[model samples]
Target chain A: MNNALADKALWDLRPGEAATVTGFGDALSVSYQGRVMEFGFQPGTRVQCLLNPGFGAPRVYGISNSVFSLDKEIAAAVFVTTRPPQEASS
Target chain B: MRRVLLLGSPNSGKSSLFNRLTGLSQRVANYPGITVDVASGPMVNLPDTELVDFPGTYSLEPISGEEAIAVSFLNEALADDHVSHVLCVADATRLEKCLHFILQVIRECQHHQKPVTILANMSDVIRDNQLQFDPAGLAAALGVPVISVSAKESQGFEPLVECPAEGAAPATPPSRNWRETPNEILRGTAQQLAAQFSPKGDVLINSQLRLDRFFLSTALGGLAFFFIMFLFFQSIFTWSAPVMDAVEALVSGLGEAVVPLIPNRVIADFVADALFGGVGAFLVFVPQIFVLTLVIGIMEDSGYLARAALICHRPLRVFGLTGKSFIPLLSGVACAIPAIYAARSVDSPRQRMMTYLAIPLMPCSARLPVYALLIATFISNDTILFGLVGWQGLALFFIYFFGMLVALLVTGLVSKASKNKHSEQPFVLELPPYRLPTAKPLLRNAWNRCRQFVTQAGKIILAVTMVVWVLGYFPNGGADLGESWLGTLGQFVEPVFAPLGLDWRYGIAILTSFLAREVFVGTLGTIFGIEGSEENMLPLVDHIQASGLPLGSGIALLVFFAVALQCVSTVVILAREGSTRLALSMLLSYLVGAYLLSLIAFQIVSLLF
Candidate 1:
């Protein structure tokens, strides 16, 4: 419920930036939320943006040791808090 | 027989492990959802025990058709009395991402009172990447026996095979509290276990990211994809031409030597015309099928297919399809039977139906011989562009492109016409780490595909050829084809194809092709051989050219074949996968559409030239 953290979505992070998932946006339907969670997007899990192929294509993200390509709309529905740039080195 | 179920998330090496234990090659690949059905075989060492491999699933909550198959099968297998143990496979390198599924499987086993063991696959990958993982520690935490096994290197099988023979105990009694944990808490528990015992670094992800930087880049990725596709289409013609010619020569030589050995005139004519002329023509195209399957198998095993799907999402979405549809559509190029099976991975029902509509239009290999004969007869085979390209190969490429364009157009029009306003499921796909493709399994798979193509299509083509030969041979003893029964029947349907400038001979080939598309080539071969030719040994293409068929008619035939749903097997599979009504409607509509378009093509060509 923190104002600054709630303002950011996973889609806002650029390449090399890491973030901790807070929760899903209200825009996502309940069933869709469950589907996303089953794909390892639960709250408190760390996710890093790896690549954003330009021209409005899906961007690549690394969660744990696995990589998944998610389109823009789905990426925008997951809320996250970006880590400090220096602390995101790993 | 005692049954042990093998279950895991997609691309987790479950199929590979099954192959290793049971010694049955079940088509393992790096792409997800390749194993769309359940397969079982007796274990190699323990013949009394059966190993069952289910299609991969993310969780018991099904999202796609294939996953639904896996979940429903699990429920049935668990309730059955013959089932004894469950071996849950997890990717050792991606333990944290895999643990949630493993926990769900464990909980399900507890509910059914079945014993479960965890087999952590890809331990060799962890070692090669210079990472650490403690299988013993993970086993203690989950209170289930965990063994690290590498299906790639055949490592750690000694312990894996022994667990089942000892009658594995129901995952320890002391962890009853852990077994009863709710689903919400199980997610956190999976993370905790992975953090404590799994490999701890970004080395694997970093390596995969380096490759994705080039393969998933905006400009470079598009250029690379087009280049690879061009090579793929070009090689289908260039690589297989020599083998095709060798097959043609061998069949004809054997016919010439053996046909004269039979002194009776009737039997000699049958062997020469039916066996050598009809079935032999279809055999020449088998090498092309093998080459096509090999290249597609290479792409699937190297993990480039997923990257290609990502690159295609934007363009495909415009046609009411998702990136996942790219796999099935491309598979359609080889054959429609497996391509229809591949559509189970698409999550949305509407999008999957759209994909089914588009799949039959993709230029499958069965149509390759028909197009090749037409092109060879009409277009000169001379090389152009400073000898860098062949005219015939370029024609093949353009024909393939035209078929794909029509598919996209039809799907786009359907999308615009439908009144449904519901939102589609999101596009989320996993990109497995790129690996160098091994040559052995790929060659074996391609060989198996060739054998399958021959056996499945061979029976139909042979029967149709025999019927055509017998009907054309009688009534005048091969003296006048016009007096034959097939000739009279063909003339009956000749009016249907007359607008395209085709005669009764072409009419008969088109009619019989409904049994199978490649039969078109074989039928033509049989007809031309019977119609009083001293040089009947000439290849079908030469015979076609010598007949002086108009260029307009040849081009019209190409267009007709591109649009028609001629294969009965494709229609049957479509009916089973979709609905009987949907399949029949598609069959009728495409037949009408093909005739109209070909009429237009014939008119346009005649006017311009």
Candidate 2:
């Protein structure tokens, strides 16, 4: 995880755990996987963990009315500050 | 002429509004990736106005190839003064999320001095939920006309059409750095706006979350996906069979009744053999085409296809295709022409090219008639294994499976050889909330697709059938086909297929079939003096069975058609969509591969039998 995320990776987020995006880690940088940014993954976004495929694979996250599934490696690159479970209204 | 550009995020009901405004039955699906190309038609009520529907995109920044297309089109429209207005469509149910794109549209319009309007689509959802949409507040904030309309229910469109033609430029340009805008800021602003409009926030999200808990679950979702696919393919066979039978019987009955009416013997033979035997053979597959399109349309409109793609992505990635490739590949089973067009949704050019290479190998509807005829002719219907599975059904399933396997193998090989394999895009797709599909659009789209397939393929099929009929009817005037001009041509190619234990007649059929795979059955029927209809299929089967062709050769023919790129329309689509080089290379490689593999299968089976 990026140092800016306080060592938090998005893949570690559980369902109903809301988080505020800090910045893209090395993998999701424009020089690397630019699509991560294109998919509305910019900083200060609120994302709630929706579902995990349950095989140590990708997990689905709901952010700004869009549901996106990201693999473990790419999910790990999305650094965020975890919001308390109570903050997730849905 | 007034040109109005309609823009929206995917699945925002943008297409429905276009359909309503233009009175055109444009394809409206529940998923995000349906409209890859722009569809344009004149507005129904406004004769001087034209509406263009663009592919949905999340942002102006280009991530995928389709998004790039959308972004460039918007840029072009902004620069061009002839475009009178830009209409940004937003989903009323998901207003908070949709505002992100709408804001970008407003900013871009401001910079270009183009007038913009916000079309609040899906107002019926708001009405059903008893929620409010404050068009006045939204209008004040955006400094543009905000129109709330239900494109599906056909309400609130009058305000849209009655709006003035002269687009007033914004008095003050809104200055916001789109690239640097924080997602939290946009989400918060959108939420505040939504709250201002509706007293309750998150009403839609809560409903969606309750459903997603089960639909997005790991095991249940996977099981449901497979079950749906199995039911879909099986229904294509079972549901379409009766309709197919009816069509076949009608064609044969017509041929029998009409052939004797012609006074000239040669013309009579031509009418029966060429027109009825040739073109009629291809018409039987139309029912299957309708069934395939209808099923796919429902799956798309119900929002299940996106989930299926999500599940298949992991498996498809292993084969060098993205989960996005699934829709197009499945569509290929119905027809390769539209499948090639659908492939434009794939983000990566390399993967798209690989997909094109695999599409022709799909056991399309064109191959179904040939497969049925061959399987019925060679394999006994009573040859049941385990007393539960009929040999015929099993053979059909195996052929489809075989084609899919070859498609995957070819895609994998091409990916391995591709130069940009290292820099592949990450798999990212948006899953929309589930909605019940309407029957009106489903049947209409299905009918439109069936019509498209027939009209596009009809000309080529007819011309080829006529030419084959002429060659066979000439040089001897209804004498033995063995001494006819077609026989001379068939003899020339006989040695090529002789290794497969086929005679000159079969060679002639194979040659004619190059125009379209279904023509194989028609040419064979004509050569054997039978109309290519369902009633005559059994007689053709009997003739082939008694003709002394080895069992191995029959299986060889089946295997060959299953693997080959035999359809001219498929090749034409490949050339048009991708490149002539790609199409030519695919044709050459598959032709060689089909011949060699069939040869090996024939030789081994001959030895065993």
Candidate 3:
């Protein structure tokens, strides 16, 4: 995947895919910004899309080997660059 | 004594490592925030050295009270002269994030001149996935000794024990130029370490995603969650019955055999009826506690519990409780005491308080015997609805359901009343990768929880039983208990309960139940002119049934027990967790609410009967 074209928000990734976190965008609720950061969601982090419970529930993501179930609202605000399936190593 | 402290980010396998080293099971699990207090034990290898396990945290910012405890304890230890080394545990599978916390620890250890070692845990996972982690490479990069160990598999601990005390300590801490944005600095450093130390592809993520597909599927996930919950609660009843029977038989047979060994009539009756009957009643429930804890431990350690919490979030949110509240609330079914302790995991005070309000009404195992005895007394044992359900079993389900309903309703009302118009706590939780729960730690944890319950609550129960025994035994000397000192007290409270068709005997039982709910059955057995051993439950029920007591009164008592905050231990915990006022107000409101509701139900049932 081309790095320039690959940059997309976290919610853009499908389940079973992986990505590198670019940066946390400001679209997330103010209350969750501190928490998302505290939980290791930041630029240069590697994350994989784990699960999205249907009916618009929070999407679960694996970042830095820790699983975090993020609300779709918050997931949409986290920016990332989608990595190719084979090279998506932490 | 020199102290070797085990430190790590939450859920980073620190407690498991501590347990492996110390041989003391200090509550290790997959979920974060299990250890809320400091635990110290003598190391097995270095017997002269003490090992301490601290609560987990992501950063030193200390967002919650438990995190504050961990950070402050570490700060204090850094200033202490006797502390020898700090062992930082990092998950090998998640080294990037673990490195961030390890870097912070390195900085602090450098400042204090204390030796530090990094234990990269979960090496078994790395090995299983055919991935390699260069612990030596990372260790070289940081100027610290890093040992690869799998606490679960019990591998790679020899080097840890043989680790030298005079090992490398960095001459200086990392530069603080990037301290303003700690995550950025940590992230950059973590990225560098990951590139050099870890393998080229993710393995666990794929397996975890495949598992989550089925477990977190909307339709199937909800069904699985409920199925597991039902099995757990059912097992508590079905699995415990035989053991309860055995305990009952031993106590009753001992009472019959041993009372004659005493010559004096008064002492004989005391030994046979009071001591054996009263205490044995509480002991019968021990097996059930074991089952409840074991099931919960499995669910928690296997990583299925987080999914249950996720599934419960939307539904529970409607009642103003976050998904995080589910563990404590479900745990409340076993015992409210630990459930209250588990509520500390909730970051939001408002949500936690709401959970606390809902907990007491969860129809704990303490109330099981009381419900069983009462239902058996009045309801027919035969199956109903063309053998679809037993009347007694349905009654049990309804009683539990009734309590849960009231808990949710109260939480909803209180959430509305509370003044948290702003700052809703987000439910961003780690959905830990599924693993086969190791039974060694799970059973050990369950055993510890059971032991804790027996030691802590048993003291109170035994004391209350003996007091009630003494109150009824003396003055008239075990003859005509209605004329005893307890009788006078019972009469004083009798008027308060007369509206529900109960006499002073039942009134006294109700009062004693305030100490603990299961005591109600024993108290009733004593008052009904029989030994209070569960072996005599049938006889006690027969006595009440033969007395022509109104059906409405039996149902009313069940209702009262369901809603009342009768357990003293729960009240004490509530006070400690929240405030004395909250506990007192909860007690007063529930007491009044239960009485009024029971009274109304009794009147309605009486008119129909």
Candidate 4:
């Protein structure tokens, strides 16, 4: 864990690196096996980029947050996330 | 309903993406304390999935209005249970700068563990680029399936609609944190991007500019604004004249045709003086007003207007306002009604109120007739220059110049009077590539705005004109109006204006304008007792000139109209928006402004001419 943190601090934020999760939440907690693939279009999935759709647009939910119907259709798609830059493993 | 949230960086075609996603379903409003509009709409992507587009921003920790709305909307939706999916839209042309917003959203989603999709808009722009960045490679790096599409051409839409998008995880889906992965290293992103894709491409996605760009943008914006304004005003006359003339002819024809049909002289005269003379004359100006609104709408839609606000930032900041005040002020030049409503975009309540307080100082369309009449009548064709340029040209120029100046002065004075805190802000503008205003939306808007003006004139201008006509029409003991009590009333008031060098007929015209300035023409037309012709308009000018009304009076009248709080509709708007106190203050301030400016203008012109 300490090595991962040091490496995380050392290596430039790149496409592929392995480190233990810290500050876990429903936002980026997608089920993954090979470098974390996403199961998108599910009801309980929480999205960070879409919280409040302004005016009349639909709102997206982060996991644990209830799903909103901006429209009626429901399908899950995949998105990938990486550790935030400048943070180190402990 | 399934929700689709659109995200992007400033000027990265976010708004255009929204326009594409939402089309005519778009509506604009503000998140609290933000000047940028947070617009949303549903996309019929899948059978039941909805699309919700958010405001464009630089980072999630939104500072300005656009960013605030973006950040706030996301944060708010995360706390709520409504939204299903998030779509991170990035501009392919400026892909790197857009990454910060994407990364920030990623962080937030990590914090919440929600899966989001990235829609790389302007894919068409990238498709045509000399340097191509691998979308699949970038998508692999982020771990989310990245969909490349151009909204304009509807490319990649079927894939987008057919592709899976869901907020909740499927049963037994990978829910591990992103940090456990090997690709999660965080160093050298920009340098790698530069080495890998930038030279052949242009990547500095996460960057800002020196202050000089803002100033340059402002200067260019000001020049462009004036040039566009000139075109706008030119179009108002050139395009709307035919329609205005036709309406005038039709109304006059109706009044004349009805005169012989209706036997009673009073009824016939009332029909002529009140309905046709008053309403018809005011409605004649509607074409010009409608054409002006269309130009404004086009300017706004094409996105050059945002640059004007950005360029106007420092000047606007001087008045304790945001650049947001610029559009409202411009809107006031057309009419204060929508202009005041436009004030809702201001983040600070104080700034919004200040805008409302000051917008009326900008001369509106109601004052246009007064200005046109004065300029056409009193301005000489002769060119007198200070060195080599014409003084009259300078004078005509100063008419618009002074109106804006008076607005600034009012803003300053009102800012001083109010105890509101004003923080200085820089203008963040997105200059959308200019496009021709399309026919359907443009014409629909023009017609809607034009219809309102005609209707209002039908209601108010006609009523007031009729009242003024009746007051001037039937003299005491049924004596001749131009010769009896009405003439006597006009004469009594005539001397009061003599100080400014106007005759009683001018006095009568001014009195009629208490209803509306446009009514001044119809009032004079009726009081001159001329019928079925615009021919007498020239004679009325002749009579004013022939009456020995000094150049000073003409100048004074113009100045007063320029500064005066003569617009009743504006007053009503102020009262409704703020309070009676604000309304009264507006009235008092304009009255003072008009008197002082007129006094100065009349004195100067009297000495010169």
Candidate whose TM-score is highest: 3
Model 4, which residues run further than 4 Å from truth?
A1-90, B1-10, B22-84, B100-116, B130-145, B159-200, B203-232, B243-368, B371-401, B412-422, B427-508, B511-515, B531-536, B542-554, B568-587, B599-609
Residues B160-242 of candidate 1 have per-residue lDDT tens digits of: 67667456753343354456778778877876776677688899899899989988888898899888877776667678779
Cα lDDT tens digits, model 3, B1-609, are: 778878898667887888889887344321233335567777777777777777777766555555666687688887888788889998888765567678778778767877788889998888888887887778778777788899998898886675523333333233333223454565467657765775556567667777788888988887877888888767776777798789888988988999889999988887876678767766666676677677777887788888877777777877889888998898798778778867876766678888989999998888988998999998999997899999899899999999999999999887777646353555777777787777776677667766766675677667766787788778989776677878788899899999999989898888878877877787788777687445558898888898877999999999999999998767876876677899999999999999998999899999998
Deviating ranges (above 4 Å) for candidate 1 = A1-4, A26-31, A83-90, B24-35, B169-173, B177-182, B240-287, B327-353, B364-401, B418-423, B447-481, B501-505, B512-558, B567-584, B602-609
The candidate scoring highest on DockQ is: 1
Checking candidate 2 for backbone clashes, the offending pairs are none
Task: Give the C-alpha lDDT of model 3.
Answer: 0.77
CA shift of B368, model 3, Å: 4.3
Please provide, for model 1 over A9-79, each residue's C-alpha lDDT reduced to its tens digit, 9 standing for 90 to 100. Answer: 88888999888777787767676666667667777678899999887788898887888888877889988
Candidate 2 or 1, higher lDDT: 1
True contacts kept of each: 0.64, 0.38, 0.44, 0.00
lDDT score, candidate 4, position B476: 56
State TM-scores per candidate: 0.83, 0.83, 0.84, 0.60
CAPRI-style docking class of model 4 based on DockQ = incorrect
Q: Candidate 3 docking: what grade?
A: acceptable
| Candidate 3 C-alpha error for residue B354, in Å | 3.3
Query: What lDDT does each candidate get?
Result: 0.79, 0.74, 0.77, 0.56
DockQ for all candidate structures vs. native: 0.65, 0.40, 0.41, 0.02
